[model samples]
Target: MSASRPATTTAPARPAGPGGPGGRPGGGPPGMAAMAGPPQKALNFGPSAKRLLAQLRPERAAVALVFVLAVVSVGLNVVGPRLLGHGTDLIFQGVIGRQLPADVTKDQAVENLRADGQDTFADLVAGMNVVPGQGIDFGALQTVLLGVLALYVGASLFMWVQAYLLNTVVQRTVFRLRSDVEDKIHRLPLKYFDANARGDVLSRVTNDIDNVSQSLQQTMSQLLNSLLTVIGVLAMMVWISPLLALIALVTIPLSMLVTAVIAKRSQKQFVAQWAHTGALNGQIEEAYTGHALVKVFGRQREVEQSFGAKNDELYQASFGAQFVSGLIMPAMFFLGNLNYVAIAVVGGLRVASGSMSLGEVQAFVQYTRQFTQPLTQLASMANLLQSGVASAERVFELLDEPEQVPDAATPQTLDDQPRGRVEFEHVSFSYDPEQPLIEDLSLVAEPGRTVAIVGPTGAGKTTLVNLIMRFYELRGGRITIDGRDIAELSRDELRSSIGMVLQDTWLFGGTIRENLAYGDPTASEEQIRAAAEATYVDRFVHSLPDGYDTVIDEEGDNISAGEKQLLTIARAFLADPAILILDEATSSVDTRTEVLVQHAMAALRSDRTSFVIAHRLSTIRDADLILVMRDGAIVEQGTHTELLERRGAYFDLYNSQFAAPDVEEE
Candidate 1:
């Protein structure tokens, strides 16, 4: 599929070299098309916009209040220019009247003024002090100026109220929005997290919400004022002179056309930019996370070239969107100024012919400038709001994801107790349904028995344990804990009874004591120490400066892998689940540490049912029962001694690990 085609400002993809973008055979990155507009698209505000308004439903009252205030403020502001024009006209009348002959009768002056199309008597009073050379109304002009001052003060106050109310309302809305996103994250299933990148998800929660917050704060006030300004300015312009108003209105449609085309195109670029940015982050994350493997295989140069490709794509997309969107302001300004020049010329002609007063001409010119000011602002912010909407759509998309099914209406609970016995009956499952991985699989672990699962890679050893833990639901059968069906129990109740220590040990950022207590937070200090001692975690803790209080960094990277494994084992021991599964729990440790862990495992599993998925055959030699698996099903089952005597798949696997590669004669 062609990636993001730009709407208005299209840029061709960079020339492709070997292995094209991101070391893949494509003209550009897979999802990123060159920045171009779609051949066609309807100008509809989609569901994302509707959803945003719905989120703001609670603040409707405040928004309505802001609208009313905007009208009043704009009405007051609009009248000030006309009042200024009135004062200018009065001054012009006064100056012309002063130049009149002192000996001339007022009636003769009026007759001569009529010939010149001037208001003969409005700028003067026919009193004794109204001398031809002098009578000025300084005190009266000051009084009139105060009214304009009052209008401006009132408008400023009204705008202040609107800003205050709107800011509070916007923040409250974004707060709820952020809270909803956090809540949605928890409700999402493990499968969601597994499939989506953490960085992208975090971008929605952080970057997207910030965009919405900032845009809402700025756009709400700007939008309200712009709408009010445009309406009031249009009305005043038409009242002054409809012909001039019509001339000024020509810029409106032209400005809109430019804004719409550029907006549509920039919107596409914004979406493409974010997508390529995510791809770039993914590439960087993967390469950096696997830095050791890259160095081991000597693919650092290849990795750098691939990153360069992604970085270049990101740069092109970002530059295209920003450059195009940036044009809105200057484009609108040029158009607005062009309108100003046209109106000024036409108004000047009317004033010269005395069809319009000089004051009125100035007022019309001011109103024309006022009209375009709002259009320019609206045109500029349109792109910002569009970008915010794009971000919001991503967030809403996550919120709309299908969640895991709720537990049964009346869930069964273990009542703080459960037998270690587990049974899987005719269970069929697959990660991808079309590619069946497990078919009609069944296994039973009797109470206090240690069941060992041995298989080659892709043999579904981990899949079986996942089924038992109910991490993935069964497709065609029932898995039971003791005698009760696992589906009947709340997932929490069912999962709490089982403890897992996987090959990958996860330790959050906290102290060693805190991480160990994570499996069972209620564990007392004494109990915590016992579990740590049991798993030999205490010995390492004591060696550190802070003992059990030693802090672990992310994923416990501050500690050695062996120590992390030991901490996980201690945590599971502290949990003390009715059933335990140690899936390659001892794999990270050295031989000496392995002995310590194996000894702890034997003691911990003495009374509970346990399943051990192992690659090292020597460790599971004494398991009560051994299940040899191949191709997602059990191929053989017996005790270690019985399996060895049978000389089957288990025999070959056991010997393979201990067997040295044969030295062939040269």
Candidate 2:
């Protein structure tokens, strides 16, 4: 099962181990970490967008609520400028209300009538009673100002509600996506992990998921409101005066053309920027994880130089991409200001001629601002949306990966008190089909027999154990326990029957007692203590100030390597399996601890089948049967003495280790 991440307010790089956020610890240019998503050009944007919509389908209700609130907000937003114009008209009307038409000249009436375009000369004269000394209508101004205030307040309230609902929708969608990623991690095969970096996998789970959350929070509301504001404001502008609406809208295409050209050119740079960012991140991770190796090899300068080169590439790409994206705002702003100037000139003529009222002309100018603002904002965030879509594509790719071969619908189990006789009949296996690692191999270990597999590197030592545990299925023949094929049994049943201790020790952060009882969670303290004593874990643990209660940190760094190995051995002992697989299980321990481990292993192997894989011949000398593998084939098989007498590959391998020390006598 994939481990559930602990809930935290801060979004870090990963789980278990993370060098630092962005790329490398204190490495890379400032603000480079903010660009963590995969490059946009590398992704299938059309499909990813469709899939993103599909991901949000379940939250349609919440989306609809947000959409409704956005519409209300934008509708109210469209009303603000119109009310301001109405207030202006109210002031104009107040001054005119006190005027008498007799005071105005005949030429003024004719000009007003011509500009009105629809009003008769008498109608225009009746409408405006211009007086030489008519004070402003204070009461009417207050009412219009109050109405404008109310409309703006209502719009702000709707905007808040829309933001709240948008947050809820984004959070839920991200939660479900994260849960899917977690579940997918477990279903993925070991081959998948082998092919990809653990850090990258974790980035998708932590950083990319967070990116999606933030993208929605930042982009969704802005996208929705901007689009709605554009539509509503355009409609209101056209309603007030088509001529001004046409002039204001003329900038849309020109602004779009400039934005589109710059965006197209920048998309590749954005992709390159993120790609190099990921590359720099990988380099940082490798250098950091192997920090000890680098120091021991005195390659600090080399590592720093390599990191610097990658960082410089990332810096260039990031700077170029951001610089291009930055162009949209100023470009849009310039065009918008030009459009605003054009509208003001045209609207003034119509207002003076009485072809349009003072209020309507004022409203038209505000609508022009509303119209271009959304376009400008959207243009600026195009890269962010692209980055998010790219991330979605990466996440979806993992979700859609081919899973491991599943278990049989009707799986079998080992019989009660079954003997542990094993057989590998004509089994052929390979990590890659083009390269055969193991072929036509056949062997058997009778009940209570200890089968030691001896081999050099790349000779399939670990691969053999993996096949038996059913971690990897056989490409050709099958193995059997007693008379039943192992494949017929569920992996859980097959694995549960076997106890394994690998060369690498894995102990979670916990007390000594907890690590000991890992293989058998229900084990009582006495059982845990007994397993620890058998594996000599109790011996050193007792020396610690906290005894069995001593807390070990991650990777068991607080404890000696030998101590960590002992805990794992103890864990296997507590499992009490019918079969055991020890892959150089005592390699890390010193000779003194090796003796203790051997004694415990000897007891545990009694009356049970055990597979011991080791390069050290001295350790497996007492085995009842020995299988010497060469290039994935068993070249020699017999008791240890027989193989030595044969004087073949096994003889050469054994003698190399057992050869007399070449150090000159001192």
Candidate 3:
């Protein structure tokens, strides 16, 4: 994986205040308004989501089975209580009371049983005839007990099955999502990365996706189970006593109202929490990357103070969001208890007055509890639901962001063996629409020719090379390769044809050979060794105890800066791209290493269309053409000797470097 390079721009004299378009100062509120506008809502899963889900569609049968099992599990748990109540009522009136005759009118028998206080098992069975060994037709009691046990067992088994299936679905979904997100990150334009922070992007890939995964894994199932329980309980309650059921439902609307308000407030806070987290992550990454500078300047106290303030801001936002969201469950529980008390009181009186059986009252109380439990759970999971939605919004925002440079609708493929002839015609570009960074830039590097770009910092030198690589689009004019507009060529085709060695060298944690072979995975051991030798990286690799298999940590911290740059050049050599772009590839090397790198670069440029951004004027003096740029346009263009003879901007720049030694001598 290629690490993105930072855009080259002139450093502002003073840091912009909070809310500036560039970025906010430490720990300040995020400038949401300064960032890109809110993205359009296209689909539930966004484009990336759709692509990911499609991959999992082949397992739809498993997903469907899981959903069906869940529904059945919920149904059984809900209806089991009603079935028990029916059996209890039958035992009390038809068997235990003895008011029921061997043959009698059913309605009469039931009415007589009620009059005789046979509504409860204890009262009805007290005076009943009992067999010596059987104890009052114990057969009926055994049957009822067996039925109740069966209901419980069935419900338990179903619940277990549902849980197993749900977990399988969630794990699979997350796997697919992560894979697709990583792929898209690879496909996106480099310019897209320039406008965003690495920490923010990383947060989206790791933290945000985990939030969604947790929601799906736990919250979704809980919500579904709760909803089914509530519905089943309400049905049974109505059957037992409609009046009691209505009374139990009185608190629902109030609970809902409270939930709506809390959720709305929490949404805003959750967004703020995510924003603060990104800022904090950015701060940590920056400090770690520049740790040497901090230590050298003895600025540990300043760094700590800055970090503490950012951490504090994150703490306040997260605390407020979680605390408020957490309150909903307890609030719902209290209200549910209040509802339970009212129903119990009312149902007890109905049973005592002989209007309802004791069995009916018990069932009504149980149903009331069942209804309240799900309601409580639903309230508790509300926070998870909101967090998932917020994460979804951020994930979708990245997927929705317009590509910096649109790909051609009918892209052409490069020839199997490309003869690189790169040309730019009056090209212009700007990262921000209002500020043009390059204007009317025209240049060409014929096949097997080296073109050197030299200018002051922020003079659009790098931007010119970026256009040739199609990292960004030309705001005006066109770029052509082999007589075809580069836009008409597929991005993959264009980039794969060019090899780049940037000033900043980044190496992932891996073996030395793995880093060298990154650009061409199929390279043989011999090819890898040859490329390494050519770039002088083989010298360091052989010195390590493990040779090519030596392990390196992130950013190749185990190696010196010169070695890292050499490794990157080694990677480019292995790729053997038709066109090469070297952006200060030798900038960090000492004079000794620079000589080695220059030798490798000269070898690389042979028979290749090459563009070099050189800060050391001495290295590029023999180039066929030298382009001098300033403030987004070409200020001077000629060979080094021709430019010196012309005595213009290039002459002055060249003279300044030589004048420094003379001044020291004086």
Clashes of each: 8, 2, 0
| Per-model TM-score versus the true fold | 0.87, 0.87, 0.85
Worst 10 residues of 1 by lDDT: 1-10
Off by over 4 Å in 3: 1-64, 86-137, 661-666
**After TM-score superposition, what is the CA distance of residue 24 in candidate 2 from its true location, in Å?**
25
Candidate 2, 1-666: lDDT as tens digits = 001211111111211110111112332222323334444454566778788878888999989988988888888878888878877876776565445354556456446556767355334434444433355677877887898788889999989988888888888899899999998987776556555555566656776677667777788889988999999998898888888888988998998899888887777775666566556666777788679889999999999998898888879888987898788889999999999999999987776665888678778877888899899989877878766775676678789988878778998889776678888877876555555556666777788879898866645567677778876667788799877899888878887888888876788999988887789999999999888888888889888999999999867889998889888888988988888888888888999889878878898899679999888888998888887766666767777888889898889899889897578877
Model 2: ten consecutive residues of lowest lDDT: 1-10
The CA-based lDDT of model 3 is what? 0.73
**Per-model lDDT:** 0.77, 0.76, 0.73
> Which lDDT value does model 3 have at 312?
89
Model 2 lDDT at residue 84: 87
- The reply for model 2, stretches above 4 Å from the true place, is 1-42, 97-140, 415-419, 482-484, 661-666
RMSD of each: 9.7, 9.1, 6.7
